[model samples]
Target: MSRTIMLIPIGSGVGVTSVSLGMVRAMERHGVVVNFFKPIAQPKSGDTGPERSTTIIRNATNILPPEPFTMQYAENLISSNQTSDLLEEVVARFKTGTSEADVVVVEGLVPTIKHPFANELNYQIAKAIGAEMVFVTHPSNDSSQQLKERIEIAVSAFGGHKNTRIIGCIINKVGAPLDDQDRTRPDLTEMFEMPSSKTNTNLEVLQMFGKSPLRILGCIPWNPSLVAPRARDLAEHLDAIIINKGDMDTRRLQSVTFCARSIPNMVEHFKPGSMLVTSGDRSDVIVSACLASMNGVKIGCLLLTGNYRPEPQVMRLCERAMETTGLPIMMISTNTWQTSVRLQSFNMEIPTDDAERIELVQDYVAGHVDKHWIETLTQGSTLPRKLSPPAFRYHLTELARAVNRRIVLPEGDEPRTVKAASLCVQRGIATPILLGNPDKIQLVAEQQGVKLTEGVVIIDPVTVREKYVAPMVELRKGKGLTEVVAREQLQDNVVLGTMMLAQDEVDGLVSGAVHTTANTIRPPLQLIKTAPGANLVSSIFFMLLPDQVLVYGDCAINPDPNAEQLADIAIQSADSAAAFGIEPKVAMISYSTGSSGSGSDVEKVREATKIAQERRPDLIIDGPLQYDAAIMENVAKSKAPDSPVAGKATVFIFPDLNTGNTTYKAVQRSAELISIGPMLQGMRKPVNDLSRGALVDDIVYTIALTAIQASQQQ
Candidate 1:
């Protein structure tokens, strides 16, 4: 849809900068090409040259237009008494630059009591520009209805056109110290207003509404970087310890560039609020400096200006610095001059002053104002709005909403496994058919403190022996096993349960909780084999953390796979990511990016990368890459500038099982990140293997993932 959406701030009280930035950022997140426009900007007197807001938008977007394309002084376009000239200039900018843009986000003037011109100007701009009106208000208990009334009156006074859609209202900065706030004030919705709000604590409101009808385009948190006086001033305000004893504090720390010669000094001086300046290839130095400075002060971050790394002696010095300081260094991969230039134009203090006010305005606009009733009045049509389910709904409420799908959990000596399965069923996430003695399963659940409610379907292996015998006999026919022996093996029920998945009696199977990986996968492999076109079976650990989801491959299977097998692991991990709704950008992780390192291990990854590309011609695959190069954009750009899968890689394919397992665990332990799965893939159906020491949440997510996988197949 080619549409321009402009956000106009009426006056100075509301947080116009923050709201404008947030809308732009949110649009970017939605993969929409949007442009920011400010028709009339009045910066404080001391501010030099152009408006600070213009610079902020330009910095955030990294797009500097030439001459008329950029915003000029309001007087240049509009005459002294004619406010309409300002609106005309804004519309012209939108028409000129927004040819290919999906939306044009124009920040409006703040709403003021005395300056009726601001509101009048906004209404005229909306009408003249053929734009929809979206009012950004602060969060107040009764503000939703009041704002709606005020907007209706303003639009009416300005001669509202039939083409103009009062899209809705956005509430900013909710959740203050008021504990007894009435969020569900019925008057707001009854007043026929479209509402959406952004909270101060979580910036995910945009993410949430993006998935629903409310259409919360973006929720920008108050970024500390937006403040002014550079990093040094912020350090003083926050009482940050300065590591660089030699660098002058008054040197306008706006753009703290990391210098190679001063890296050791930079590492020591790495404070949270400052920017890092260093050489590009000196990632080792940069990483070490960050590690060292991680102890006391927050390193404002790194800015790698030069395209070079530190020498070995400097690297050694950085390592020592890391041992001394213990802080994380931030590194920017841009060239030194470019980094400095970008930093210089940006005024940091623009964000600090009115971030809270912007948030409050957004919350107020987004407050629970009804859109359905408003649509009837505005468009003469009745539309129903979908309200999100309340948080902490009862288990029955969720269960009633779920599709009926049957899953089987094979019984074993480890009753904890069965208990975990039973708990998943109770939680309404899965319907598990436990393959073991019902009495024994109950006993295990009791011992483990897991409630085995009526939801679980238990099938005793003794009673179901005959049902699995024929399948076991068929599976073991070529292995020189007699019917009796096959029957006994099938009595294990893990084998029988796997047979059910193979036979399509159940949608999916979950085992390996009590059994070893070998035993658990052996039966499935023998009977099910690889899926069509899948050459080899592999496993992946869905290493999920609070902030990110990473895939580590060959962690549970293939003790020490060769190059070809490692390649297979990469392809399988990529497939797993695709199955789980993530675009798989596979990186064959090693100790090197390209030819930076020597040794058979590096060669193995290089060969695996080639093999993986040959196998999955459509996938973006790169190899012999260090961990940082695979995930960090600056490192990726610096190390492998031409490589497609370097910095933006999502799936990490390890060279061997040892590195795969060890690296993920080390990251988990050292970083205090959560790791789920060692999830098995490449089977015919969705049968997953769990860790012998799996937690309840682990079992729950695994079951959910398995169900999702099975649903896709269906």
Candidate 2:
């Protein structure tokens, strides 16, 4: 179960990243599993400096989420009229990234520069991911009156839809002074709107509503030093090396003070926590700055320009003062004007390696932000979110790691298979036994630069012929097998691997890398046979679509199934889904929806659904529904409103292989979805097959599934 909270800015520079990450830190401190994601990261010139906030939080947090795709692909999809597909992929990734978390912090984009397409991206993302949103507005941008108008306009624009839930709003970067008078004082509304107004009567008034209005959650006061960049950060970004690293680790460069003014005039302008930039030959000005530093004033860092250092005597004096003052000195080749221009575009980030900054951010947010409101939002018995691709992959890995079963592969010399085995062993997901010549396998691995980790065993299939020949003949003598024929069959690694699984030598077997599904599963069918009370083996694909990981059954096997075979396939597929932690909602899919388009195919599906229900009475099974009705709520409401599994079916059972195979492939290619299967079910022991064009990750997950299946069977 998960609750997603999306943070959006009224405009750019509205503190979206700070609040999003801060909440993750706060929620996590209370032992809550908090996950963070930035789904639509826009890349420019192949640089990702803009996404440093996400990098910082992920580095400092416990969540290891998936990386975001560049917005270039999303733009292409939008221009090509594939917005639905893009939205699906986004939701799918969101589901995967946050599936295991109690709360998910979805950080969204506010256009850094003015743009045309920035209007509803956040709203669309919120709706697609089923998340409630909280808006953050910068109070320093405008006065109390102007800020109120902007807030009203932004709320009207962003929360127009009836379903849009604006949980609260945060007034950040408030300009009010902290317990100090005699400054330019903006009213309390400018700082943050209270529940009822008690300050300046000239300011705008606010009225809170019961359910739809924006509630006040946080009022963050203006803090210049808290948002400042470190001296070393500027040095690295500017390609300038530090001459002295004294206290560079702790000092923050808040504002830039140009020493273009005279020494007498700039003395008044030289404030604490501000970088001082000037020409290198200005020894007179440097002496005054050192005197000020020696007088117990904090200066951030000193930058000398034009690639020059001070004279020997001046340098000695400056070094002596730096030792006592803890000041960092930097020299840059660029002149003062050029340096100022370069610093104009420099973006500051919370350093990924700075534990002190991380703690400060967390502590600051916890102190000012409303923990009471966040507790009310996150503390409850929330319903389970639909299983997403990221979540499924993470859970699959964890389950495989926990079970740690032994799964063997016959085609170990195959590159993808070898790589997958190496990954499984390295990740502690499984122990793999490769059926091939160990020397040749190692040779191929070295040629491919694939290092095989420990817990992987390589066996020569030819050497195992003597040991398996008697058992092969004993198991297959009914088909007129002899010792000669048995040895010949054992020459094939898949046949020998099947023999290993049949004798319980290995927990599971996965093959079909260089062979057809028939060549791979034929040995298993003949040797291992079906499980207890099972009629025949069928195949299922774990279709990892955008929003959810769906189970599609009999997509690779059974050319045409009768009612009984179809029911058996559904039952097995449901069991597989449940084994992988999905609560099964089975849908018998056909060309019809609840007898609306009756035909032979539809009738067959109806009968199969009935049979499946009788076999497993507790299963949430519905039938005679089309694909849309099975998965879409609106279509189900129109077509099969009373069916339990109509709109939210997690397992779909197709009527025949012709329709199922075509549909799964079409969805996979057209939507850029991932399919991890054609996994053969109903074997006495676990044996799975792979597609010829399977990726390395496909093989890895298939092996993980095999390991988990082995554990379940045991």
Candidate 3:
């Protein structure tokens, strides 16, 4: 699809240049052609050229041969005062460049408060270029909420009526110590799970922001190489010994100097991966080694690191190296030690395990990148066809363990259950079986907005009375209930549907709109009797927000479950996490960390932690932790120093529903994060519950997630 991404840099003192370069590097890794543009740059007096960020972008993407048009600077075309024209110029340039390149990344100027033009600029540029916004936020404890507020304000102030889609947020320069913490912060990235955050790479940060079809891109680390420094500092940081010295030479090697005194000596130590530098004073030796290393030995980098004039012989050698190895001899203007120090202080954390990053980025590009936009821009060309289904499904059996996947509707005299059921089947998300009259089901779907699809199997309760009677009798065979009594229970009607799931006739049942939670799950519990070892079937609310996603467990089912039940809830929640492509890191949430506080509430969680571990020995489980200690690494590290689950817990098992629901809702309301479930788990088949107030899109996503869960169980 369309590859153009509008990279809007926000906040003051944020490293926008570092982010831009990182994006280019990441795109290069994917073998995608990238063109860079700066829509606006606040010029400084005595800075007679383009912004420094532009220079960094050029250096990062210099692999592509320089084209006259590709290197165009917007100094004369746009100015800080001309905010309106700036938008037009940026869009025109971006559109023009997109035609030649696979993707174009546009970086906005620094944000402003007094004049407050950056928001307007961002909106105008995004709208004009049809570019999605990848807002960059400097990582902070309150970064998530701050970003949400800033975005809301910007959208309100400058977003206008235009549908400017925000792909995701990138927490830039997420500081080294907290990198791991940020990487696993469910509360932070949960809001944008579809587009997960990239960790510790600026290129990744930029690519995440620049690529269309928005997914949570990974977090980026600060790159040391890009930080300006002297030549000598570079050598020391790289652990290289300096060989040459000169004024002009020092300037050339100012960035990344690998110093050596003599060309011949430096050449001998030039391991294939080693960085080699020769002074112009030693051109003869430089020429000789350049000729020698031309065959199979690939030198990492060659630097002419001194001010002394280079002899013709060295020039010939450099030409030979260029022709044979295609490696540029970078010229720097500083001594080795100075360069080494500069590079040393600027450390960028590069994620070695990036398979997940690639997968997530691809998912975003596949799902959100506008195919139509791409086709129009690329002469009717589109991205290759995707192989996977657009939606996913889950089994009802899986939903029973964690939460009740009930499709609730307004109580009505007419049968609307069938229409809801039909909606489930037609969408290929849920398996729906009619609980009422088959004939009436058809009439109701026609009357309502829904149309029943062939996928739906209508089971007439009256017509199939005998069919379910035997199963009901068998389920209560040992419970001392007679066939007549079992049949009478089925007469409640919804109980028969629940019996279908218990009898393994269907995966699960959904009938809560007309019935209370007690009525909805009572028959299943009485009949199905909590899968094999399950103590109780608890519930977890998957709060899906635009900013993050969270799991609030035991919220809807257990009001104040005892220690034994809480333990079961913990295990079930962790299992549910696994079913949804998330590896469980269970957190037994309490008001106390360790034994800091004493109370019945804390005691229950502590006991539950013990029981949960005893039950699921292999799971990473820890508990009796405050909410902050459970989710925040710094807080967890301090509060529960020895607990493995502290600070990285993905599955939070609250002590009680009140605490669970209240905490989750507070986070949601404060952050405006979307909450998805009470996703039911622990059933024998794929059955889910929907809130009566659920939106169509909410239903669609939940269904997809449920289907995925079901497929995994299979």
Compute each candidate's TM-score over C-alphas: 0.47, 0.54, 0.46
What is the lDDT for 473 in model 1?
72
lDDT for each candidate structure: 0.58, 0.77, 0.54
Q: How far is candidate 3 from the true structure (C-alpha RMSD, Å)?
A: 28.9
**Candidate with better TM-score, 1 vs 3:** 1
- For this target, which candidate reaches the highest lDDT against the unseen true structure? 2
Q: On residues 91-125, what C-alpha lDDT tens digit does candidate 3 reach at each position?
A: 56556555656566667656655325566656776
491 Cα displacement, candidate 1 (Å): 3.1
Query: lDDT ranking from best to worst?
Result: 2, 1, 3
lDDT of 2 by residue, 1-714 (tens): 568888888776666767776677656544456688888775433254645556777665546766776677778887898878888999989887778788888887776563446557778888888888888876542445666667677778776535457777776666533212222222211122332322222222222222324677776655544567778878887788677777788777756777887888888655556688888888877777777777655677888898888788997877778888877878899998788777755654466667566656664664467767766655673544556665577578879999888888999888778878887887678998988888878766753346787678898887777999998889988998999988888888899899999999999999887999999889988999999999989989999875578999999889999998999999999999999878899999998888678778888899999999999998889898899999999999999989999889999999999999998999899987789998888988999999999987799999999989888888
What TM-score does candidate 3 reach? 0.46
lDDT of 1 by residue, 533-575 (tens): 7777788876654324667887777878889888888888897
Query: What's each prediction's clash count?
Result: 72, 3, 100
Worst 10 residues of 3 by lDDT: 385-394
Best by TM-score: 2
